[model samples]
Target: MMKFIGEAMNETMKRNFSECPPFFTPFGDTHKCISLFTPIKVSWFEARMFCESMTGNLAILDDINTYIQLLKYIEEKVCNCVNSKINKQCEDNERKLMPRFTGDAETCLSILEENFYYFSDEWCTVKLSPLCMTNKI
Candidate 1:
């Protein structure tokens, strides 16, 4: 995994290209920068903490384009593990990684049901990797 160096919140800044990971793909026309953490699994709180540690936020994918692109990227990454010595294990990890958290919760105002746009809050403590975002597009 390539570590990108920079503080991105409101805007995407100009940084040294050499430090940027090639896998960090820009989603659609937004300023959001996303990277998957398939190798690490943590609870929702931990996931958020992890992203914050990197000066980012757990990708609360509210944009259709961004969400779609992320899924596609993940699919490609998982598929590429076919030749790995632990191919089955890798594929299993990918399955549990999905239905990722989106920073939403079940509140008194409303109850969120499972759907393409949102996932079950029960996954909050399920110890899984999350997509981190530097900026919300």
Candidate 2:
């Protein structure tokens, strides 16, 4: 089925790009890899294109549970980066989660400071890290 294909693709991706850790969650049968942020900030369109180049797309919170899980994942990842004894890379990259570009026409989703989900139909012009996702192939 598609899940098997997605898993195979993910395995291949992990083998090829070991540096970027993909996020996986049992919610919604999510076996996708997500790039929380790109090395450089880019516009929403550019961010979507970048993800597409990687055989992925802009992440979408299909439901409330998925959104909750995604928020938790981001928080855990940030905490780990902060606790990591590695270089200052984590501290340097620590930033508010950008209101990610969703597939919804013109509307984007943003997690507020208190971990609440909000959406707007207005266009976003600011450059920020893109949250990308590779769904079931």
Candidate 3:
């Protein structure tokens, strides 16, 4: 059956696409990881939807080092981009959420911000990142 074949192919792809250790695809192939800025505010689920709708999925922070650096970059950008107490607060909130989720969080769960990972060398090896999006939050 066509459905059966599709399912089989899906399974095959999932099996072959498995990532090793800390390396994982935070977003699918559609959306690219943005390095710039955009004040895109939405819920985590909404962010995922936005990513998918805009040709990607939610951002994923696989390690801690890159996460800390990225956090500082975002905060610095925010401090410079919009210097205000409220802006700082909002940016702080956003940074807190970035590395909150792991690759697999099927059910609603909490995250530990102490963890981090390295910079993704190539966006292609996974799926997304070329479209590094900035938050329009």
- Give the TM-scores of the predictions, in the order they appear: 0.58, 0.61, 0.37
lDDT of each: 0.52, 0.56, 0.36
- Root-mean-square deviation of every model: 7.6, 8.0, 16.1
Of the two candidates 1 and 3, the one with more favorable lDDT, higher being better, is 1
Q: Cα lDDT of model 2 overall?
A: 0.56
Compose the digit string of candidate 2's lDDT tens values, residues 1-137: 35434644665566534333333222234665565652446667777786777667777777787777777776676546667665245565424344456556665555433444344333555565666776543
Report the CA-based lDDT of candidate 1 relative to the real structure: 0.52
Residue 25 lDDT (model 1): 46
> Residue 55 in model 3: shift from native, Å?
2.6
lDDT of 3 by residue, 1-137 (tens): 35433543554466323331111222223222333213443444554554556444445455565456556655554346456543443333333232223434443222222333232222111222121342222
Number of the predicted model whose lDDT against the real structure is largest: 2
lDDT of 1 by residue, 27-128 (tens): 456666676666676776777787778667666566577667766755566557655664455555234343334445621111121233244445456666
Which is the better candidate, 2 or 3, if ranked by lDDT?
2
Native-to-model Cα distance after best TM-score fit, residue 74 in candidate 3, in Å: 0.8
